[model samples]
Target: MPISLSRKFQQWVSAKLDLPEDVIMDIPRITMIGHLHLYIENHSGLLSFSPEEIRVLLKHNHGQMIIKGKDFVIKTILPEELLLEGTIEMVKFIKE
Candidate 1:
């Protein structure tokens, strides 16, 4: 379940950030820039993110995570699909 940035996503990010394609697509142990926090999924499946939460569907019980911050905002949300924006203060991963 190694998470990989799609080619289209890579191109978009590279152009937007003026970064090399390889740099933008590199798998990071942990990625945080400005208010964005991204975690690479080790297993492939549906992934969800929010300003204050993250949910990853696994083979077992649903995994739930919480982010703490007052100004957190979900810039976009399509049901389980979402894009989070805010000053990330904390990140917690849970399995259950």
Candidate 2:
């Protein structure tokens, strides 16, 4: 994918100002607590959810995130954030 001038500017500004790229670039922020709790910020949408698998759409060119676990349960869900609880086994990011 080709990046726009605005994206380039944001990247430059973030680097020059020593700011976090994830905030400026619309990247997803993922936080994992042990193997049980998962928090995702800046997500675009939820693709699918189940006890064993969860898929999320990311913003910009960040692609999609696939989480595989057991006995998964959602704690909080919002327009741009999600919280999941379960025995997380694997996490994968796929660009398509």
Candidate 3:
């Protein structure tokens, strides 16, 4: 139940499956291409969307991701992945 124990368990699972710790550890994987494109993996939900901002929910205590930019548009949305395209200006995390 403690943080240290949970971390150890996550590390063990990561090693066993040859997977990145973030995946097993319920963390979002975000990839950005310059300031024009964004890709997110393992997102829980979309909290808000607009031309200038976007908020996505993440698992665990990672909370929500706030993306601010111009001409923001969702290129794709799947059960666990999201692709956004726009002129990205800032990215921040809002914890629960």
Q: Number of clashing residue pairs in every model?
A: 2, 0, 0
**Cα lDDT of model 2 by residue, 1-96, tens digit:** 356788889989999999998888878999999999999999999899999999999988689999999999999999999999999999999998
- Measured by TM-score, the strongest candidate is 2
Give the residue spans of candidate 3 off by over 4 A: 2-4, 12-19
Q: For candidate 1, write residues 1-96 as lDDT tens digits.
A: 233346577778889989865355532223456656444332223355544555444322325555565455655544334345667777675666
Q: Pick the candidate with the highest lDDT.
A: 2
| TM-score versus the correct structure, for each prediction | 0.40, 0.92, 0.84
Q: Model 1: clashing residue pairs? A: 1-42, 1-43
Report the Cα lDDT for candidate 1. 0.51
Regions more than 4 Å wrong, model 1: 1-32, 36-62
Q: Locate the minimum summed-lDDT window of 10 residues in model 2.
A: 1-10
lDDT of each: 0.51, 0.93, 0.92
Q: What is the full ranking by TM-score, best candidate first?
A: 2, 3, 1
**Which runs in model 2 stand beyond 4 Å of their true positions?**
1-3
